[model samples]
Target chain A: MFVILVYDTAAERNPTVLMTCRRYLHRTQRSVFQGELTAAQYRELTSALSTAIDPEYDSIVTYTARSPGMIDSTTIGVHLGGPGDIL
Target chain B: MFVILVYDTAAERNPTVLMTCRRYLHRTQRSVFQGELTAAQYRELTSALSTAIDPEYDSIVTYTARSPGMIDSTTIGVHLGGPGDIL
Candidate 1:
């Protein structure tokens, strides 16, 4: 399945969170990440994130789309980042 | 369609971004928003966000799901917020 993961962590922990996500997904926005991942990879990604952030105040939400074709994205202003093929 | 909007803006502009999102979607995370909306409402959301943010730096990405039923979400850490019904 394809997943869109959005996170909000403390400024100091943000780098760790972003690095973990980049290992499995594309950094489509400063706080948003998306890409295809198998169920196992998704589990791994979540597991890594759980350790990288402080749940007490940090927030990470994952939205799953059954398939890549199911996702439709739009950019409102300047494109920050996205899949290489789409760019 | 159901929409998930994620934003990353300067601290000074964050409130404007969140407020605009709240007008049309349920904020499910510190920087992420999601909800079902008519096509027109979606248009309005993009317009308001466009006017409220600085494209040169602010990043806003919208993901569209054909239907609300199609969205599957997972929270790895403590939930910060979500739709009132789901809460």
Candidate 2:
């Protein structure tokens, strides 16, 4: 699935969340990441995030697409970074 | 619909896109916005964005949720801002 994960966490936890996400997706923005993942990879990513986050404090929104055409990605400004670049 | 819009455009167009989007949704981050919109409102928002964006150079991803229950929003850290904030 194609996943776009955006997160908001405590400043202290922010680095860990960012690190964890970068391992599985491309960091598109300070708190956003997106990339493709297999079902198993998705599960693994979520499981790892579970430990990195404090369920009560952080927010993560994951958009999943079964195919590349499932969601449209529109850009409006200069590309800060591409999906291939590791944070 | 509930929409999550993320954009990456040229630096010059970035401010315009951000300003345009802020008129419609809460600016959760530097390049991300999200909010609820009626069908007509969605159309209007898109129309405005169309003119604000250079299709060839900018990118925008809008995630629409028909209902609040349709998607899971998980939180992990201190809330920088809520959807209520205008910008």
Candidate 3:
């Protein structure tokens, strides 16, 4: 499946959250990550994030599609990084 | 179509971007927003955001699906506000 993960966490927990996500997805831009993941990997990613963040202030969301092509994404602005660069 | 928009912008421009998105979508978290939009509304949103952000440092991304169910979403931690609460 293709998943896009977006997160906003407390300043002190940002590093941990960022690092955990980078381990599984491409850092398309600050606070945004996306890539393909198997069911197990997807479960693992969310679990790691749940453990890294403070439930009171941090929020993380994942949007999944059956495949990358199923999602219509548009980016307006300079490219930072991510799977979007592939032609 | 159902659209999910996420943005990371320079501090000073955050308010403008946030307000613009709020007019068209539900604020799902600090940096994420999602709602259903007509093609005209989607175009207007991208245009508004493009004018509000500094391309060199800010990025705005939109993900669209045929229907809300086409994209499976999972949220961890507190949701600031959004359409997610509906039964």
Candidate 4:
């Protein structure tokens, strides 16, 4: 399965989480990684990531299996909020 | 299962995909949506999203089950590239 994790803050993007994730998953491209992880491995990785992140920023994580159909459904957006807002 | 759909451009954030997704899933919050979809539904949604996007921006989609461990594993980041580059 492939998982896409999005964080609203740089603090949440810690080196530990990035290195650990890279160790388990192949870096498909810069800032983009892909791997087929079992449910157990997925849990371990997510837990490690959450722990390393600072609580001040919001984070959104999504996972999907490898399928052409699933890949087709994926969407992306960016929001510029009010002053001092982090989204 | 929960899915995180991230788009790097507003063009990819089409109303059709968002509405269809909302009809199937609950809106967890503004810019954040959640729901339990079968594999089939996931395929349909991703497919629709991919078609709606302009070819200019990069989009990343991630999916994961509704496990505490999985949620904990998510990570997010932002990259500022060279001149005229969009991250």
Candidate that beats the other on lDDT, 2 or 4, i.e. the better one: 2
| Model 1 lDDT tens row, B3-73 | 98888788999987877788888878877788889999999989999999988888888999889778798
Q: How would you encode candidate 4's per-residue C-alpha lDDT over B1-87 as one tens digit per residue? A: 555443343544556555655655554323444555677886777676667665445443444354323443332322211113211
Runs off by more than 4 Å, candidate 2: B1-3, B7-87
Give candidate 2's chain B TM-score: 0.85
Better of 1 and 2 by lDDT: 1
RMSD of each: 2.7, 5.0, 3.0, 11.8
Q: Give the alpha carbon lDDT tens digit for every residue of A1-86 in model 3.
A: 99999998999999899888878898776888999999999999999999999988889989999898888888888777866542
- Per-residue CA lDDT of model 4 for A35-67, tens digit only, reads 556778877877776677665454434444543
Q: Model 1's DockQ?
A: 0.72
Off by over 4 Å in 4: A1-8, A11-16, A27-34, A37-47, A60-87, B1-6, B10-23, B27-33, B36-48, B60-87
After the best TM-score superposition of candidate 1, give how far the Cα of residue A42 lies from its true spot, in angstroms: 0.8
- Once fitted onto the true fold, the runs of candidate 3 whose alpha carbons sit more than 4 angstroms away are A84-87, B84-87
- Model 3, docking class: medium
Q: For model 4, state the Cα shift of residue B53 in Å.
A: 1.3
Label model 4 with its docking quality class.
incorrect
Clashes of each: 0, 25, 0, 23
Worst 10 residues of 1 chain B by lDDT: B78-87
Q: For each candidate, what is the lDDT?
A: 0.85, 0.72, 0.87, 0.47
lDDT of 2: 0.72
